[model samples]
Target: MNLYYSFGTVLLLLAITAPTALLFGYGGAMATRSGVAPLRWFGKSYIAIVRGVPDIAFFLFFVIALDQGFEYLRHKIKCPDWNEPIRQGSDFVVCTAAKLPLGNAPQWQHETYGFMLAVLTFAIVFGAFAGNVLFGAMRAVPKAQLETAEAYGMTRRQVTRRVLIPQMWVYALPGLSNLWMVLIKATPLLFLLGVEDIVYWARELGGTKTPNFTAYPHGDWRMWYFLGLLVFYLAFTKLSEVVLSRIMARLTHGQATAGGEAQRKAAA
Candidate 1:
């Protein structure tokens, strides 16, 4: 039962993370393309720094730091009476109320808290990659169309909304499709965040069980479990490729890119 639930956990993480990450990427891309210098620099820096860091290192470090940072803030607010230092010769201390799930939290609460952290971490990491793809897509928009919009007395914002936004997707879809595939592959990293995802279950349930632990003690079956996982991922990505290709065709139907050119030639 737990193993079955782990499959849903993987899908749920993808469903939530994909849109949230896209929102982050969109914001970052827009900032990098903005007229304001600081905003542009911030966007570029976020994309470069996060994307450059190895995923496992980021997962190990960021989750702990973010968890501690939250507890520290809560400790200051909820345990002001304490005079002891938070850092006690290397061991960090915080009030019971400051614990994210509370010390006596139910098992489900702890799992939920861990899952939330995983989602946020995934979003932050993948969003940077998505932003880079989108930034390049934004630049890939032809200068001629933008200049034409300017000459037509269109404001920068208007040109962005009317022409730039709509057209960039044609160029962006291929990169974004690859990013989506990468995101699917990265889902196994949920284990690092302490979330019991499919990979975790495969290893756990497939391991040999002692007679004391269960009546149905069995030999190691990890290979079969992992093979099932391989099939699941391959099928999912194959379907995604088909769907994304269709979307790409739709986006490029009348545009001026190579995909569009091929599409027009096919129609003719």
Candidate 2:
């Protein structure tokens, strides 16, 4: 039950967040290519800043800040009349009632809340990378395609919707697929965000302590536990590659890109 619960939590969190990241990424890409200078700068800066940071640094920084920020807001809303001090030494103390999801909530609620936070963090960090991929893909789209759309009496919006976005995927998939792979690899970071993901449980279950504990208690075995995690990640990446490759083939069909040309030649 624990195994099923943990895996389900991770999968559900990923399903919600991956799409969110993709959508934000697409928006960022479009913004970067906007005709207005300010919009372009805004988009480009977003992509640039995120891409420039180490993923671990961003993860640690954002998670702590966001957690504290949420608690602060709760303190203001829930304890406005009773505050002595929110911070004392290294402790951030909110009134017991203000604890996120609350200490008295069921175990499931705490797990759910932690999972939600992990999803948000993943979406934000990966969205920036996705934005960079998407921006480059948008630019890689042929200028001629846009010009032709304009010549056909299409409005700018029509040109973008009918031509630019559709074709941009063919260019973007390679980069987006790469980003997806990175996102998958980064899932282990969920442990840092306080979710007991597979890696965390694996370590816990595999650890050896004493006969005073149980039959499984023996010696240090962190290496094998981590090796299993490595195997799981490698398998997941290989499966993802297969799926993305098929999508790539579908997207490339009849397009004016090299990938499309390869498909045409193969058909011939």
Top candidate when judged by TM-score against the true structure: 1
Encode model 2's per-residue lDDT on 1-268: one tens digit a residue. 5645666666676678889999888888888878999999999898888888888888888878878889889888988897477778888888877789888899989877777777777888888888888788777877988899999999999998999888787788898888878887888788888888877787777787789987767687878878877897789889999999999898888987788999999999
TM-score of 2: 0.86
Q: List the residue pairs that clash in candidate 2.
A: none
TM-score of 1: 0.93
What C-alpha lDDT does candidate 2 achieve relative to the native structure?
0.82
User: How would you encode candidate 1's per-residue C-alpha lDDT over 93-187 as one tens digit per residue?
Assistant: 89888989898989999988888888888888888888998899989899999999999999999999999989888778889899999999999
RMSD of 2: 2.6
Top lDDT hit: 1
